[model samples]
Target: MQLMEVCVIAKCTYKSETIMFSVSSESSMVDILKTLCLRFRGLQLGCFTLRYSVPSYPSCFLETDSDLDLMRTFLLISNEKTVDILVKDLCGISEYSGDFCVNKELIACEKGESSCSSTVEDRNEFLGRSKRASAKPLLSNEWETYIHHVGQKFDGGAEEFRLKLCKYALEVGFNFLYAGNDKKRVVAVCSNKKLEGCSWRVYASRCEATGSFVIRTLNNVHTCAGRIRESKSKMMRSRVVSSLIVDRIRAKPELKPVEIIHEFKDYYGIDISYYHAWFGKELAKLDVHGDESKSFNELVWYTDAVKETNTGSLCTLDCEAGINRFRRFFVSFGGCIAGFQYCIPLLFIDATFLKSKYKGQLLCASGKNGNQGFYPLAFGVVDSETEENWTWFLQHLASILLPMGRVVTFFSDRNQGLLNAMGFVFPGWPHSYCYYHLKQNLISKYPKSGYGKLLQDRVINLFSRCAYAVTEEEFKVAMEELVIVGSSKVKAFISDLSRDHYANAFFKGMRYGEMANSLAESFNNWVGVFRDLPVLPLIEGIRQKLMVLNSQRRFEAEKWTTVLCPEMETRLCENAEAGRTWAVRRSNSTVFEVFADYSVMVDLEQRTCSCRLWQIDGFPCTHAVAAILAKRDSVYDYVECYYKTDFFRKAYESPIFPIPDIGKGLGSNGSAAVVCFRQLQRGQPEDHQQRGSKFLFVVVKVDGILNVGVDIGQAFNTRRF
Candidate 1:
């Protein structure tokens, strides 16, 4: 409620529109603008800044927390009251139409100036004289009635109510009485009177954010603080700058201290120390996310809400009542069913650090879809990436994965935790170590000198080539090259790791050809900023991204011209071109011999070539291409089902149902019978689903769910839901 400096404006105008308000000359432009933004959805608040144009000086933004009177002096334009809100950072703000600007004309008027609006010379004098306000001294019951009415009109967030209270005190000649719990409550008393124990107090009653707030008027002074003072210190405490910083962090919790310091300084011209900025950031979080420890307490409710609303979503939280009360948490959308079935069966596992107040590790299990991009299947939050933690993660993963077999493969870095965990959960299942991590580990272990630098580069290059080699012969040649110059330690490292796990040549036909954990690594980096937030916020952020990704990928799939995805199509074309030089002899309609440096028998019936490229990789190998050319086979039929656009569409067909805000009650389609099935393509609850007549139900994609409705051909079928 404190105005530090005073301004007396001559005139006001906005060249664009005629906007009217309950005028108060004493009110700061910031307060007016904020009130306007709240009322008008058309106002792009954060994008634009208030600016004042003057005759002698060029037009500039109003950067300080200054009052209207002080700002008017700098205005050289005829209409000193008018301020332009110059908008910047225009991206995605408008989707359906072009960029639009609203022009507002603020006319300067002297007739309605509040008595509190004072000039520099008489500012303190006016405020000092009018510091206290008079209220019709009322009984306790009447005061309570008045408080209730005030709360009804301005009932919202505590901060918003705080602003309203400041305005009310200024209007009614009262001041903050000050009382118990200064952190949460604002108590206002008669400013006209001296600080006393029996002053009538108007208390802001903050309730659970979803509900309305009530202002309570108390007669008794069970708890009271000294009367409020009008000074720089008082102004600093109740100023909009702190609240603005808090709002910024609430919008983007990932903002760091440096960013906070810079933002505060740049906008307000007030230099805050790193610690002050940090304190502001923390305070902001407290307002936005509530208590850090309490967020953990809400995990159970949050997960239940998620599962109840999202249906097939997997949200599991495990806690142990030991020294470390919090243990592990894992969550995944039911859309994973589609991803696992229609996308490549390769899962990339990786762990990233959580930079929130409670430090931990984020373990992710992601798959590569037709577009060769990260298709996040599941995520786990653990105390650390230990064998036991990973085992817990993998064990839970096994639950949602459904009828797991050796057909599904996993890629991970050579972490002992993953090795041990995968060995237990997947036992005989094929596990591939990331080639990139292996090379990085090898390089780190064998630090080389000036001349050895070249050797180091060569060793890394050889290892990479070995992993990517087209055939066993090519891999063998690279191994021989490494042996001639490789160190004993490097050689031992290479020998210890299974070739089938890292080397493309050693891997048999059941291969997805994913030699690295790039899917998970890239996904981790994609959500790098979100990971810097609290557990719930991070998960919420990822969920939002997944929703967008599901829609976007499906949209992109709709535009594809070929049967296979763009990348697969491009790869097959390249192989087909290369196969032109190779000579092929037809043994039968479905069999052919491709003669190159070595003879590769291509069996069209089995869709496998002797070179194994056609089998390991979903795309047609050069040998397969040669046979297809000789046998006149359909190029479309050779590519794996996972590479097709239809499969890609199916991979992202189901929506990840949105979970409602924590206190907004259940979602629109939330139910109690509970969802034990995958998410539907539309937003409708299972209980609400109406059974239809004898419709053919065929499953083009096998997600282990027997959805027995919808017309289709040549796939698994069912009769009813």
Candidate 2:
């Protein structure tokens, strides 16, 4: 019996009576060697005996274990020729005591005498042929070759490789680990399973993403590079500030501050995830600090940057609100109006709704002089048209105007708030209700009947007369013809007025000839340009109107001064005639001049400066200015009494408004016409729906499907779904 020697490979081993062996035909020698190294402690034996037995075949025993192991090792390590020599010397390779007779058959088969026969030369030829695995280097020593091969696999199936790459990138540590064969136009990745079914699938990673390994090849790495570059370029497109400034630049080319940013998107594509990356960096630069303490940045920039830019501003702000919106103009109880160097006594007051589309508060104001044409001087809005709103409005108004002088009188609508707010601010100041509102209210209650006409005439007459009405009784008699009872709306209105302190004072002191709030009505009519507008446009319109009005007023003032200088000189000469009428006058140490309008006489010594012109112009009117200057009084005193500090301060006092207690009004209910319809058959798909005749009655299903019928209403019947 010939016993083959066994060779042992391990890191370590313990002596034992029996020797253990493991063999595999599927793997090459190197694979087997690596597996042995992993399983055992150390290489222990050079050779060992072996015996083989199979259920169908016979058994084989090695004569000498050392010779067999040596021969096997030689077969593994040597070329074909050397293996042949070793195999020949080690004949009787499958010796079995019981199979000795059958051995002759195997020998015959080996000699090509049977179907499984093969000549020794032929066997050697088979042994010498390289196996598929043997043709390739071991994976450990051939990393580059592996990558290249895997890359080739990807090239063979590009889309499949891409899918694999995407899946792997989503998994393993290598967000992406890929190899490219630019010349072959292929890209490959190593992941969980052979990507696109390529050669390599080494998915070893510490990432917990997912343990899916795949090796995949992709076609056209160049295309990927180009796309990536395009994507990057698109990502780096326009900056934030530049983008924001683009519209501004386009709108006003002359105002362009810097480079223009054309478009944020690009040809390849846009990645929304990358927008913040680029925009954030650019926006940070917008936090610029400029020189001016009250610079535009503080106001417009701060709000625009922090709030407006991030969100968005109302589009109509400047267009509507800035250009056409009304602002409140206020004059203190005793404040004088001023224009340029002249002070005027008259104050025109009114209230209008805010133009902003947002539910804006009300806007009340003192109107500008004729020259300025109702330019608003101050402004405010409130949640409601209440006494508080009016009071707050008046107080703020008084503050703004009073510094100029005391407001001799104020004109506004008969709104309770206006009256109450004034009273709160100026306890004892004269105020006038808008004549239009008063007239409208009266006309609404009583048409042109004798009594209505008489009442209207009387109210109108009271304001037009010269002497301020002296007593409440005399004022009452003027309206004696009007109805004064539960059936009379005018009578109730009058009675209500009598109860109001401010209104009472106004009626008592009403100068029969003085025109009331006609000017305010006109001003309000002009401001109609701004009604019911969106916020941005409303604000913009108002601002623009103000700017234009102010600019025109300033221009007119300059023109009036230029044109009337010589005329005033002549007036001064005439002033010298009557007790030496001086062109200028001094009143309580302040000087004023009277200009134009030759109507009233100017008495410098008496401090009786008139032209009533001062009231109309909101300035001293050349005559008053001239008169005051004659006395060398600095021509400042007669500056409209309203402009004086005492009066000006009074304008700041709150105005008063009388709020009516809310209650149900007469006749609350009413009815109007309406229409109804229904549908009939439905569910089945049809080419088109039949149109129903105008007056035809049709049965309609609850679902709105209609069916044609002679009288659908009478024939209506419910159907189960």
Candidate 3:
């Protein structure tokens, strides 16, 4: 066996010493232990273990022969020249024994002269180093791990020190207050100082040399009971709470006050009031997204920024008479306006309530893309859902869509204000009423107690059948059934409504199979989370959502390989399958006779069938499908151009640019001084007056443009109330 030089290091609570030894490669654990005991002289009296001094493998204990062999193999593989072993005390009793102390010096002298080749000078050099220097405490960045001591240094001045002290006192479950506070110094003491004479105190002063605060005196011994100190702590204020929950609020802005209270109680073992949590959350929100009141003022800059970045876009702001008070605001992105040319011409108009500090109404005009997806055309915020407001919104919409020369249809519930507005703005256009809303009105008009709900359901079903009927004869049959079962009032109500608005057979414009304004409802639900924000943020949020929707749809449309959209293709395929059993007879190149349950005439040239489904739905119906298949023609050719993949791509090709941050280069030095309108006082209770006043200080820097008599129409096209 080959011999190797091994260095054995012994460590205890008081001292550490090293000695050299000559060992054979075949040495076992027992052999090494016996040699260590004989050489150290103190190991014979107490429990100890031998471990390899490999820093990477600190717990490699050599307790058996296999452990010794593993250590040797590891050392050989690691190419270590010297074999280092650590002798650790297992019982920690022998290092302090008088006998061990007397034998340590004798063993050192013997080893100094032995053939192991370790000298007394080398031993003294290792033992002369201070133990405190080797075990110095490390500084921690976490406040929970910080320990206060005299002469400790902090980077910031009195404010930073006070903040850290508050956090530290809270972490340790103790109450503290400032005994002396100023810009140059801060002195904190236990809150129980007057009652119990608690000695816990920390005094920090600004250092003249480094301009940082340094702890001049610290007496960390507290004499008060733990319960009293923890229960009476006043360190948990709104400022501290804001600092603690700022990051959480930034990640989830919808976090409620009750959730914050529960989080503090469960996580920090502290109880807080609802007001503190709410105020803290408000402060954090201000830090994250700015003040809600100021966000209203940012609207002017935001509108200008949107117009500058997105060319051909229209943004108008309306103010009350004689004062710069906000009344209504409207925005229509250029991309959405340009893209509407490729979407379905039918617009679903609706209004939803805003849930902000200053409550308002959100009027939306949404369309359907080629794939039957919701496409928002334009939206605006108004003071209320009145006829005048609706008329103003429709005027802006007309300015965008009327120039396109396309025959558009308006679909919505029969809200009186909306109906009146539609009549005033687009008098010649076709407006369809949602049959669902009409049925709801009927249900409300006739209570279930008069005749059970079953009768109501039957009446609504018969009316729905009439609305869905394909021809005048079918509608007449459905109406006869309804009249036989319905009361005289119900019959009168149904007769008063125009059949051209609800009945599919009499509708003058193509409805595209839509019977309700579900698209606007969907848009409302999509932006529901952001409704609580102020006016500017709500508008910006909608813009961001539309931007993402357009980009995502454009990317998805790029990957489509079908000639028509997937929805239209599926509809065409289903119609072809249904018509498989039907027989077709050719009349001419453009005319054919399809025989099924009832014979229908198909005109391929007009893209219509006698059943009326093909022309109304913008696709080949069952009869038309049979006739087209008989002629060996493709069904996709008869589908409307709006349902083509090329049209879908065009609908989402325009990009919606991001609006830059407000107040970038803009200042509030202009002559225009805008304020929030106090319109809620008209019909609201006294308690709502404060919420109405939240919209404040909407100052716009008109510069010299408005003063120089620029046409108000050319500048803003705004309607003054």
Candidate 4:
């Protein structure tokens, strides 16, 4: 007689799944369970052992082939209506195998309820039951939600995470199972959602490493299911979300929270809130720029490092008197000192507002080198552009400069504090207001008057012309035009303005024909991006930029072929070409008269022109050029040293050494180190920067081993080396 065959339904309450498989009365229980596990592609029956638990029948473990048939007889012949079958993992979580269709929709289901349609919305959760195993979509979220409810759902407020994880596996189409106790089952799902088109099965497992448990995806769990498709579980992991947020932040720091929420739905197939992305970005800033307060505290060491690395570099970090936080500070490395030697004597000092927790102004003292590019001499951060702060800035400049015996002209706006400070600090030096700044003040003070734009334009243009006028005659001509326009108030203001400081005719020899502080303004723009950084980072960033500026310029100069710098050569060529129509008649071997529309005297011997261009700019004017060419003299010979390629090269010869962090988390104001730039003169008060050997950093051992670094050279030491 053939062995009797009977169908048993194994219902999985978690996935809302049930399977029907025929079993023979003679078949061993082991074979029955093995066959059942093999049929369900998405189920990991290995984690569970089959058992027959019924009221009449003592809970019997069908551990052997004989036990299967013995239980089949009881189901058939006994008066029991059904046999309560249970699949349980010895360790709660049975092993998972894709070789069987465990997590997938009933591929062989000639039986019960099936999974949701493959045609769910991109935003929909795609893993639950809808209709019978024959067809149709999974049930609504109400019924599907129970898939997340493991163990006893209606039991108090507690729910099992194993079933919850089972729901996640169903959602993502992963081949895994929760194989622990229902009360405290460990949920193990496929960690790598990227598993697709592969023969191997992988599950997420938490294992101990270095005394800490880290989640890892282990492969080698084989699955007969064709190829697991790529899908993300609706279950969102904290780490996974954070990591993706970090990537998006680095790619687009301006990415908003709403975009992140949509990103989870679109790219990740998961849902996240807007606030999550916002808070995540806040955390990301720390990862990218570091903690702001910690960086501020590190400025002391940062300053020390600049002095140490750049040798003759000078830096001063002064905090508020009582609060002992950054108030006003200045730094000018050795390269700045060396560069200034070949630069024009004019210094443009100005201040721009800083955007930080503490409102302040960034004061920059900049000059123009032979290349006519901004030569940042020093930078200071001040609470405001007060007289004391400006004085402090100029005083630091004076300490190194006065000892050199060279009085440098200063070009600045008529900032009351800066003007007052300049008069006191460099009393002998000529201080001029930036005419452009004056023009701005004029425009701001006198808004659109009854004078239409035309008149407004005329007044502004006339004032601008006054700044560039090479002679009092030229300035007076513009001034008369302004007065002709009938703005008596403007005329009076112009008349009161000292031509020496604002007019090219007056500041001719003193300021190199420069009447504006555009150089300082440009310098402010040069390090504008770095100003937003914390104190230590801002200083380090500025220091790094200077190094790049020095290197790039040096490299550029090496490529120049002209005796004069590129810009200077261009100027001379233009001027010489314009002087082509000049009528030059030799007065003597060294003198000539150039009547280029106007008669002017050019004395080559004195390196001067009656127009004063040659003397004031230190470069031959068109008149001087015409005279020099008339006598068969080289025009290059008439140019100033300040315009020479070699002089420009000298300005960048000293290196702006790289500054680095000596230690981590060096907080602000807690430590102190004295820094000097251009060391001070001996027998003098030692708190100033002086002209000395370009770079010398000396460190004295403090505790026989550790070094206390200081910048000291004969130039700044009270006791000479």
Q: Could you say which candidate leads in lDDT?
A: 3
Each prediction's TM-score against the native?
Answer: 0.62, 0.33, 0.69, 0.60
lDDT of 1 at 422: 92
Better of 1 and 2 by TM-score: 1
Instruction: Candidate 1: list runs displaced more than 4 Å.
Output: 1-242, 321-324, 404-406, 595-601, 665-721
Task: Please report the candidate that would top TM-score against the real structure.
Answer: 3
Question: Which ranking of candidates, highest TM-score first?
Answer: 3, 1, 4, 2
Off by over 4 Å in 4: 1-283, 320-323, 445-451, 484-497, 662-721
Tell me the whole-model lDDT of each prediction, alpha carbons only: 0.62, 0.36, 0.73, 0.61
**lDDT (0-100) at residue 373 of candidate 1?**
73
Error of 1 at 382 (Å): 1.1
RMSD vs true structure, all candidates:
18.1, 30.6, 14.1, 16.5
**Candidate 3 clashing pairs?**
none
Candidate 4 lDDT over residue span 471-519, tens digit each: 8889889878877873776867767677777777767246776767888
Write down the lDDT that model 1 would get. Answer: 0.62
**10 residues in a row with least lDDT, candidate 2:** 83-92
